[model samples]
Target: MRLDDLPLPDTPAARAALEVARRFHSPAFVNHGVRSYLWAAAAARSEGLAVDDELLFVSAALHDLGLEPAFDSHTLPFEEAGGLVAWVFAAGAGWTEERRDRAAAIIVAHMADAVDPAVDAEGYLLEIATALDISGRNPEAWDAEFRAEVLEAYPRLDLVGEFTGCIVDQAERKPGSTAAAAVAAGLPARLAANPLQL
Candidate 1:
């Protein structure tokens, strides 16, 4: 699906999520998420992952929303992105505490290379987001040099099953079985869905 084809929220919560995302994301990253989501949806459809287009679109759009205030520069390799933009965005989207927190975990734990276990629902989405992020060019406002420097911080990633599952779960109407399980069962699907041709 194209960016215009991706789901746009009619609800206040989803709208808020978009507003929150616009603050920190460069147009390129934002565009990448749309393309990635479309690819991810296609992968899920082919794999029988049973995820919906809206959930997939919304989740992908907000996946990186958790970048911290410090995200402005590449001084820090990665920040606690899980909660950075997620907390506020989820709230705008009117997600449940459980759901919002689960979303937050993805933002905070997004740094795949830095994460100890490096396998969880949130981390899984982050991995896909990051891969797709650097794969394309970012907007000038984001600073090309800073984006490249930050991209270098992430080394070869070792994906966990649980992380990938989160994408599946979120795409599904079930919205992932308690965040923890998202990565557990969704990794293979997530890895398969990655459109970077990795």
Candidate 2:
């Protein structure tokens, strides 16, 4: 799917999520959030997965919020902390309790090695999208032209350096967290090797 063809939701909740991301994140992170959603939506279109666009967009926007000082958790992993933040945001947006839970679930699930699309399509898409954005995993899945469009719309900026510092800090603080696992698995090398670097 073309980047333009995947319409970004125009709902109040969607706008609010973008606002929150911009307020809390650096330009690199804000762009990462938006790009993650676009990549996921594009993949969903190609795979014929039925997804809630609002849910995916909101999840993508706030997935890394826990990395920010304002919302960073002392005890919980970053993703878990971010999930709680999403839950509260959904409540303020007047989403149902079930929907709020699902949003939070999607945020947390993005840290998983893999999420089954049949069970939680939004979560699965977010996982795949973030991996693509962060580590350049499966970049070839998206055509070159669409990738260029996405980068043009939301440039990568300094995501590699910014993300590395946040993730490394998370790994040091929470030794058992997914961030730690990723660090141990050579995330720095992967980030350096990411083909999306511009």
Candidate 3:
């Protein structure tokens, strides 16, 4: 699906989340967030999995929010910090406690290497979308034309380099954090394996 054709939530919560993300994140990061949601939706359709668009959009939009200097935590991993910020935003947007908690789960789970659809469809979709965007993993799931359309709409802005740098910084600053673990686990090799050339 083209970026414009993807199913995006038009609810107040979604709009507020988008606005906040745009205001706080850099243009490249915001673009990446938008593409992540679109890709997640496309992946959900391809897999015949049901997803909550609002929850998924919110999760995807704010998944990397902790990378923003303002929200960066001294100890928490970016994923956890981002999830906390998202939970607060969701609650303020009048989401039920249950919904807000679920959103937090979705945001945090996106960092996992694998997500079980049976556990949380939104999280699973976000994982697939994020992996696709960051590393170009699972390229075959999306047709070349569709991928090109998404890239045209939201350019990469050298996201691989930018994101990797962010993780490297986090690793250096927070030795026991998830980013540090990712670095220790050979993040460079993973990025080399999945190149986003579109």
TM-score of each: 0.47, 0.98, 0.93
> Candidate 2, residues 1-198: lDDT per residue as tens digits?
688798789999999999999999999999999999999999998999999999999999999999999999989999999999999999999999999999999999999999999999999999999999998899999989999999999999989999999999999999999999999999877987889885
Alpha carbon deviation, residue 64, candidate 3 (Å)? 0.7
After superposition on all C-alphas, the RMSD of every candidate to the true structure, in Å, is 13.7, 0.7, 1.6
Indicate whether candidate 2 or candidate 3 has the larger lDDT.
2
Regions of model 1 farther than 4 Å from truth: 1-10, 52-56, 65-79, 108-110, 113-126, 129-198
Candidate 1, 124: how far from true, in Å?
Answer: 3.9
Off by over 4 Å in 3: 189-194
Q: What is the lDDT of residue 77 in candidate 3?
A: 90
Better of 1 and 2 by lDDT: 2
Model 1 global lDDT (CA atoms, 0 to 1): 0.44
lDDT score, candidate 3, position 40: 90
TM-score of 1: 0.47
TM-score of model 3 (CA atoms): 0.93
Runs with alpha carbons beyond 4 Å of true place in candidate 2: none
lDDT of each prediction vs. the true structure?
0.44, 0.95, 0.86
